[model samples]
Target: MSNGPTKRAADWAETTGFARLDAEAFPDFLPGWVWLVGAGPGAPGLMSLLCYHAMQQCDVVVYDALVNPDILRWVKVGAELEYAGKRGGKPSPTQRDITLRLIELAQAGKRVLRLKGGDPFMFGRGGEECQNLAGAGVPFRIVPGITAGVGGLAYAGMPATHRDTNHSVIFLTGHDASGKMPANVNWPAVAKASPVIVMYMAVKHLGEIAAALIAGGRKADDPVTIVSNASMPHQQVASTTLEQAGAFVAAQEPPTPAIVVVGHASDWRSVLDWYAPALRENPIG
Candidate 1:
């Protein structure tokens, strides 16, 4: 019988009524096929039921750096684990190699799970991988997860959109492949496009980004919230303004893997903050 974390997780699931769900509702993990699954932001509980189902049956799990290690406990025994994460300024496998490996594994008749953090289609290169799989005649399934921008902001008590604040919200990545601000982004237009903007991988170029938005007509005093390691045990939220964001980041040096929100929507955080206290009451190991 399984012991330790896996056993405890199973017990927790059963207690929470997951065990009562119909098993046949989930699709079979067939051999010679691949499943591209999203692991959610950083919290194991945020994972979808389909994602949990895949974890229990895959023959091999190829996961990313952002995937919480706590989630791996649910994997069935004897399954292989492979790390194929890409961290900025670090040596990592090329995207082509990762895609090719998935194809090879499926071709060998192994049930493969290409797991990624957050929604795979949202700036995760999942579309590219799926394109490659389709070209290779490989069958696959896509299971979406809660994206960090929306989910991470909520954990920080900042809503991506407020009925009273914004009618539309924009999502964008801060950096490009060259580790610099994305060159093709229309800063001024983007600034005017929506009332709220959520950025990913933006901490490194926050200063430049803030300057662009300021130049694009956003007020310097506009609210900004930075949530680091969102939904994780070490999560930290820092509030600042567009004018002070650059200095705030440099002075405080909030940890990376953060989500940055710009707009009046962040003001809600002051009133809606809940996760911090919840963590205090029920801490996770």
Candidate 2:
């Protein structure tokens, strides 16, 4: 039951031909409230229905660099779409500016949608935006989407965890706020405990990070795979070892928006791999 001019499920179905859902089942996208939504890896099919439903109701969409362009096609025709993405090594909007823009939009009585790639909460700087919104006394909703570490890996035919390969998985970023190796990571301790390690945005210093993992007791030959542009049609994956990951990447020069997975779970890509089920999409092949 909704507070608006509610449309019957049958009427909605008769118009859109989707019989299972009613428009009123969802919370109304009220003006002056912001919704931070995760667009999920790169595949439009991977996006959550809630994210899609919310996008359809937004008055403005402020999206990130990683968000798949295909998903933008679903935004309501009249909605204003704005790009506020920040890509590494590229000139981009400051985070403060982005957050301030959101506040400004909300104050203007617009239903703003902040669409991010993958789960908004997972290293998406979503928490910061939400904090800013809270301080400004603006109401907002958080819509979780599949993270690339999980969903992107799956699309690349790699699992972050497997009973036989790993009992635990660790996800870490390559760079922190400074755009260098993270200052707080206890490399050895993390390397010792994590059987499957997924590294995000680590391409710039893959060599140094790989060396650290090896020095910390990880096997030099431990299988490591890099997945780039994951879940997208142009996705690429590269396989190397802890000792050679940096060199392999340097020689191959795989593109950015990549993640590095270190551990036995990546070995499964040899057998269970199915980036393109019909196409046999192995980057090495």
Best by TM-score: 1
Candidate-wise lDDT, in order: 0.89, 0.87
Q: What is the lDDT of residue 133 in candidate 1?
A: 98
Top-lDDT candidate index: 1
Give candidate 1's root-mean-square deviation (CA, Å): 6.4
* lDDT tens digits, residue span 1-285, model 2: 776654564476566544455445788899999999998888887788788888889999999999988789899999999999898888999999999999999999999999999999989999999999999999999999999999888977887788887888999999998788887899999889888999889998889898888888889998888889888778888888889988898899888898889987777777877766455343221
lDDT assessment of candidate 2? 0.87
Candidate 1's C-alpha lDDT? Answer: 0.89
lDDT of 1 by residue, 1-285 (tens): 645567445656666455555534579999988999998998888999899889888999999988888889889899999999998889999899999999999999999999999999988999999999999999999999999999988888877888889989999999998889999999999988999999999988899999999999998998888899988878888899999999999999989899999988877877998886557443231
lDDT of 2 at 63: 97
Rate residue 251 of model 1 by lDDT: 95
> Which pairs clash in the backbone of model 2?
none
